[model samples]
Target: MAVPQFQHLAGRVWVCPGDPDPEAVQAGVAVVADERGSVLIDAGQSPTHAREIQAALTAAGLPQPRWLVYTHHHWDHVWGACAWPGVEIVGHETAVPLLRTEAARPWSHHYLDEQVRANPRLGPSFRARARAMDSWADFAVLPPTRTFADVDELPVGVGLRHVGGGHAPDSTIVLVPDSGVMLLGDCYYPPPAHLRRPDDGLDLVLVRRLLQDDYLWYVSSHAEPMTAEQARSAVETT
Candidate 1:
């Protein structure tokens, strides 16, 4: 597998390259730092990915993240919490139940089998990674140590808001006040049925409000960052 590239977006903010294949679910991890410490927007898909992120941070002269905030409880975003042993994991209260469900296992053979059948070209590489992940006997879901209902302040002037009913039941958005960047995770896009609710207009309204703010950059988990104007236009058209 190719090593993911981390790009610096602004002062003390960097984003790792996201999965290029739409069929794949891995998200780019956002790293934000301040004098106090650093904070990771989302843990990567696996322990190996998490370790690579750590190395990148060290190379960039940023401190190990003091907090790991999950945008949602999807397997690809939250599975790497095991890599940061002592980091204070934070997420919306609803994510706890989702993470503890039986479906939240570290590696799922059934899911891999389906992926192989669906996309023959990418199946082999996906299966190879799956087999490696299976060997991680110590892998387990690490529930967030701190849970919030609506809004919470995090280290480094970062703020988290639980924007319910979007990409995931516990979908949240991370805001960097200083840089005017907001990590939208997978919230402002087409989501799985189980993860989406009927009242999508409310979510759109919230998104529009955020975009209208002084935010300069809007970063999506699976795509390159967009300017506030581009974000607003996309949301309105979609």
Candidate 2:
């Protein structure tokens, strides 16, 4: 798959890199900004990437996000969420369990620790920030004061609909009804749907069920912008 790059699509939507890995747990991040403010969809893997997202938001002239939507509770997506202090942290109700407990598990914490391993020169800095800035449940996860299950519409200044969840059990997408744009939270894979097994993360089968047609463009939390046609094609294959 091609490396994802930030692109401004029509209707106040944007996608940008959330980390140096750009794969697996630390894939990337997506942003939905509008006149009202911005909503960060699925924060990156760690505190460093989270901070990076804040910087990007500033560059875009968007107000600090009023909401931070986590596609699911995976470490890569919500771990750095603490970086966005005041925004509401939204996610599938099922996802909260992992957010509250997963970080404490030896494997979960260890795996996250492994993700920080990086290029020789970048290793030191990545290591320092990764362990120092573990996910702050109190500040990040608590704010989601608003939540829904299976389906929900988050109004990010502009409307952002949380669509299908083919990645994780709690995964979903952020849809823009007007521009036909959607921000997929780990919906597909590095690109989408076909990159992994049907049962890998979320039920790709169940997630694909929501779309009866391909009328929406998309911005994946890990991938790049895909047109309605592209999305429909992937849906067909799935």
Best by TM-score: 1
lDDT of 1 by residue, 1-238 (tens): 5567678897667888767775556678998876687898898887777888888787777778889999998767876789887789999999888888834543566767776688675564465457436446567777788999999998568899988655677889998878878888988665653334466443566677667477889988888899888877877887
Expressed as tens digits, the lDDT of each residue in 1-238 for candidate 2 is: 2333456777666777544443233656766776576777777666666677677667776667777877666556766776777778777677666566764544334544565453344344345445545454443433245667656665543343444444456666666666666666665542332245545653446446545353466666545667767766776776
RMSD of 2: 6.6
TM-score of each: 0.83, 0.69
Q: Least lDDT summed over 10 consecutive residues: which range in candidate 2?
A: 189-198
Clashes of 2: 7
Candidate lDDT (C-alpha), each:
0.78, 0.59
Count the clashes in each prediction. 0, 7
* Predicted structure 1: lDDT: 0.78
